[model samples]
Target: MFAFVMRRLAVAIPTLLLLIVFSFILMHLAPGGPFSLERELPPQVLANLNAKYGLDDPLWLQIWNYLTGIVLHFDFGPSFVYPDRSVNDLIAAGFPVTLTYGTLRARFKTR
Candidate 1:
């Protein structure tokens, strides 16, 4: 049993490393800055927004900031393009709906 668990951990570590490396590479492959949506804003407002989110830094640095944010801050940040609610709040609210859907799906899928 111990050997089985140890083997699983050994396999998982490489998978995690590959996922992180792929995420790093894929992030660079994507187009434009994160603030691409707010381009219509005045320069000063854009600066302020970037500063508020720490987006003024390099991409690697921003990724570090966001990863640290998820680890330490427990703040998932707002839902992108969703004006009415925060991302964390939206997830909290939607969880029940998702659970209900899953239950219904399971009930129907087995039929």
Candidate 2:
């Protein structure tokens, strides 16, 4: 039983890492960036915004930083859409509603 659990964990860890890396890559490859706006911002301002979020870093470095932040500090950093909030803060705020809906759905599931 212990060996089985360990084997599953070994596979799961790489799977989770691949998922995170692929999602990050896909998001960056999309058309518009988080800072894109109808009216163009000054170059300096755009550079500052990118630097602030570590988006100016090389893609590999960004991924490393993101993974380390999660593994070591459990930090999800800040939300690009909401300058005032961290990703963790947003998740916490919505978690209660999510839990409520999830519980209700499970209780009423057709199966």
* Index of the highest-TM-score prediction: 2
- How does each model score on TM-score? 0.63, 0.87
Off-target runs (Cα >4 Å) in candidate 1 are 1-29, 32-39
Worst 10 residues of 1 by lDDT: 32-41
lDDT of 2 at 89: 97
Off by over 4 Å in 2: 1-4
Worst 10 residues of 2 by lDDT: 32-41
lDDT of 2 by residue, 1-111 (tens): 999999999999999989999999999999978888577788899999999999999999999999999879989999988899999999999999999999999999996
lDDT of 1 at 59: 79
Which residue pairs does candidate 1 place in steric collision? none
lDDT, candidate 2, equals: 0.93
In order, what lDDT does every prediction score?
Answer: 0.75, 0.93
lDDT of 1: 0.75
